[model samples]
Target: MKIAESHPRRRVAVLSTVIAAIMLYLFIQDVFGAVKKQEETEIITERSAWLADWRWEAGTNDLEVVAGGLTSLQVFAAYFDESDSLLLTDKFREAMPRIKQLAEQNELNDLYLTVVNDIKYPNDTDSQKNTSLVTRLVADWESRSRHIDEIIAALETFGFTGAELDYEKIAEEDWPKFAQFIHELDYRLQKKGKSLRVVLEPRAPIERIKLPKGPAYVMMAYNLYGGHSGPGPKADAAFIRKHATRMKKVPGNSYIALSSGGFDWHSGTGKAVGITEKQASELATRSESTPERDKASGSLHFEYNDSDNVKHTVWYADGTTLSQWIDAAKAKGIQNIAIWRLDELGSESLEQLRIQPGYKIE
Candidate 1:
């Protein structure tokens, strides 16, 4: 359908209008994107400031400050038998007063009485190596219920805010039963005005489990390299971020736990033993070896020779590495960061934490 062509001036006018509209649309989009970015930045800034203020208010210690001012503390106190009876440890009883004082002074809202089956006592060497007993505990409903009742009773008796189920190294086939037990325990605890927090290993299939809305799932994000493994960082940045991403799939709030300790590995036998920062430092000093930081893992390592002329490698996290862990978690939008054990932190590391900027959730 051929028709008379429009005048050249009319055609030019139409083209100009279309071009102007396109430009206007792009301008509005650009403005909106800038505003959104600005809002995100502002939220982050506010959260960081709030965390800093909380740190200032707590003033307990550097580790506590760096760890969000000790809102919660988990105590590894006892182990449960198939009969659901607790075998209390002397170490648990000994540490109670100190933990209580710390809670009172910091006004902490939650105290987790951690119970596990793999360990009969604190620092039990076979704890992580054995999982058969824990697997059995999760399989029986009666045993699980009895354990729940005892946990709630203990929480009440000790004035604990909640109970933390730290049954680790469960067989993959028993994950469903474990998830069910957690749900049941959480239900019971809620009725008593208490809470339940489950400690999941880094490799735990969190997606396969159904957690109650009330309890928080804490992922042990460290141990990427530990005493059981070859000489390496306890946790590298990439390892932490990988777990943090998986943790997001967990329901409700989740925490990223870090190790503040170190490991000593024998280069000759490839056997690694866990050590405290103090112990690592003492060994390094005796051997006259200076610790060097590995930029790739953000961890400090040093090589030293022992009395038998056996060369050894020690890899550990210091103030700088801990800060890097915190930053990695922060970048992943994780709000809570937990140190495996407060006692393991060295004085220097604590001081470093005190001077660093505090972290907070948006």
Candidate 2:
């Protein structure tokens, strides 16, 4: 209270203490910001690794199949969701041999159930129309609500390991029914010494969709047709990683960025369909009306070259974009990569897919 005759040095010391405190606060804030940025986007997540074994899409080796083959993911989609009658009765008798052979392949890990949403819906039965390959399910929900059982029986019968629900083009109205199907199916699979592992391949928000409590959810915002809409894989990986880290749980075994690289032209309009000029031109002139998305002209022929050349082609198709994909994946700590529809791919195109980082051909 003596108006404390403070020395100038003492005043300077007090000011220095305040300044240090401010610097420390600023340093903490900067650190928090950097961590937030890294966790918020796929660019900083973690890249893929060799720690886990790989999976590859299989069953058929057409162009679609081939393009999907480059990654470790196996068997594009199991082509399930056929007629409810056929699914229930095992009407795919003729296909048993192939399925059996596929099952026998030791490298096999997962089988995708492509039309997941269509597995429990109704469709027109007009023979005149050959548009939808999807024969939406119309079987007993109680008996067939267990779609997992439907698939597990086959997977178990064939000795396969995994199944994917590739419900790509589902309408919002169908989500409830789809959710019910998953719940019931997973319950059934768990009973028969078979536990169900689901990949929530929904195109909508994970919140909007109902999923089994334990199924692995592959969080994605995809436009099956609109390839490069959002920041794409870059942003997607980050978004998914953030939730995964915060939730302290990882859905979907690996972080996969969906992509296709077979035909650069859509059959109808301007879409990429992994085709060559010849195939596109043929469909264009055919009395067999062409679908309008897009088409490729002067496409390279997929004749057999060595695995080296095929590998080169597989690695380069969408060269620029894939670079972004791989880079994003590495950033997101994503280890497993699954491509859809490997069976639709062509041979040479498939041969080019890289099973590993370097050369991989037997």
Candidate 3:
């Protein structure tokens, strides 16, 4: 009886091994086939012309009162990994009404709501998955994207013109494919009278080389000022000019009204004067320049935006002990001044925004 039972088990084990071998062979074949297909379409990305602009200057002049020029303001409500739907959650959803109310009060001209990252649709492709993790991310690319579409549709309920796009970090080699993907997505949005704009990180020059033209703004963020104080703005603007010159439109091929980059600073000059980062950052909450208390003087680069579209830059640091930064800005011939960032600034900063902001867009 024991021999008969063991004999059947041995046969079952042999069958299982055969099936496993066949599956392994099929997977290997599929891998090679995909690699071969990828190689065939490796050279299809198109390049466009570029323009340049920035505010981090060398030896500065008077360009102060760099706040309130924005009739349009964008608060990047980006989501953390796995938190993509946070924008739809209670806090964000609740905040949406308030946000729209604010925009209405300001009479905002344009609104761009980016649903950054891959789609999270239930049927999203495996390419959307991050294979690096053991547990795995819950939402796939298609699913995430679909959620954004759902949110986009719902946003229309608020009676605002909205746009959606994925600003995902993509590989340079896959740029052509990426462009094709975005173009298709944009096509879908156009049907709804909505548009999509792919956001980009300017610091990534290599990836920037692969980006397609259809974005409204370069959306410049990250480190800008105090880049080694060597070559200076005229030269930096030359390289920047290349990036901005060709990007004068969005997917519909319309001319972008304006192009913008920021003029930001770190508090090294503040530290020089022995003020803590926390304190300097706190004081900067108002447009009050830090009294050379170990801080670097800040300025704006409004040179590229063609008068009406640009405003002077505001700054605080140890090098500039000027109490009336507004006066200094007027001295530099800046006609319109604005605070650096609305998010970091408080009511004190907003009070400055109403100060009949100065002189010229020309």
Candidate 4:
């Protein structure tokens, strides 16, 4: 009888022990699972800046103010001459010394030269983006080789760490050849211990295009609304997320270029001109109009009358807008960002770039 009673107590002890083990396992799992989820959600980012040739003074000044935060700097300085040879703009020539000084002081060795497709005629006539020139230049081997040589030579002469091709308005037929040229350039540049960056317009068929694997591809994400369109935010959350998704097809390290300004549209003439954040803010203050932030885009929009009593609509990205843009890009798994033509930026926006923020991936 005593032995049977002991058996029941022993069985009860075993069951209780099993239950305690399971409870301890559940407790440890819950604690560790929370940590793993937090680790997975944390996102970090990097930032770079473009110093425009046309606005080199302001760009240089702004860059100096934010140099400590930048990982690299691209001088938007090179263009095509009348003969399609590489030509450095006058402003770029003048700003080189100061730029070099800043780079050395800031330890920014990843200096790049950005060459655009624009051709400046000698007569000071209307300089334009010559898609025809691009077609002929890249489609023909002789021309393409010569152009690549010129770019490489310039990079060597100027000690640029890399070269950025900002060819815009490329005809659809020329894309294959353009892509071929990029591959060829990347090969040659790599041989010479240099790097290459290829900038794609918003309309580029990234999904179907077979771009070279070596070069860093930059997708121009801004310009959803610009001089070409009516007044609106330069970029919205949807626009950025769409391009960020589209950029998945682009090989290698890629960047989404965000702009930091807005446009003022005149109602009478239906003409819109670009304006900086400061300019937009000043206009709003002058007209005593409150700029309302667009919830969808995180951009500020307002209406004001000019001195001539012409009604105008302005849409611009401020510091808050930039932060929101960064978050939108992060949600799409893009961590590298480039600011287009960093000139006359407000302090808060500069801070956003400097910190290269770390946020939740979602």
Per-structure clash totals for the candidates: 0, 48, 46, 0
Model 3 residue 247 distance off true place after TM-score fit, in angstroms:
4.7
Q: Which of the numbered candidates is closest to the native, going by highest lDDT? A: 4
- For model 2, the stretches where C-alpha displacement exceeds 4 angstroms are 1-83, 86-106, 109-149, 171-177, 195-202, 219-254, 262-323, 343-362
For candidate 1, the per-residue lDDT at 188 reads 90
- Model 2, residue 83: what's the lDDT? 53
Candidate 1 local lDDT, 1-362, one digit each (tens):
13445577678999999999999999999999988876665432101111111122222333344443455666666674334367665656655665566567656657777776644444454344247766666678987787677888889888888888777778888888888888899899888888887788877877766665778878888887876688889888888888888888888877788877688998888989987676787787856657889986788888888899998989988777878987888688675766765444577666544442333224
What would the per-residue lDDT of candidate 2 be over residues 234-275, giving only the tens digit for each residue?
Answer: 223344344333322443353454433333322233333343
Candidate 3, 260-321: lDDT as tens digits: 12223333321112122223454345443332222222322211121344322222221122
TM-score of 3: 0.43
Pairs that collide in candidate 4 are none
| Model 1 stretches with alpha carbons more than 4 Å out | 1-68, 81-84, 119-130, 287-289, 352-362
Which candidate order results from sorting by TM-score in descending order?
4, 1, 2, 3
Candidate 3 lDDT score at position 337:
26
Cand. 2 TM to true fold:
0.47
Candidate no. 4 TM-score: 0.87
Considering summed lDDT, which 10 consecutive residues are worst modelled in model 4?
353-362
Candidate 1: count of backbone clashes, pairs at least 3 residues apart or interchain: 0
Error of 4 at 288 (Å): 2.9
Error of 3 at 343 (Å): 1.6
* Candidate with more favorable, higher TM-score: 3 or 4: 4
Residue ranges of candidate 3 with Cα displaced over 4 Å: 1-71, 78-87, 118-148, 157-160, 164-168, 204-215, 225-290, 293-341, 346-362
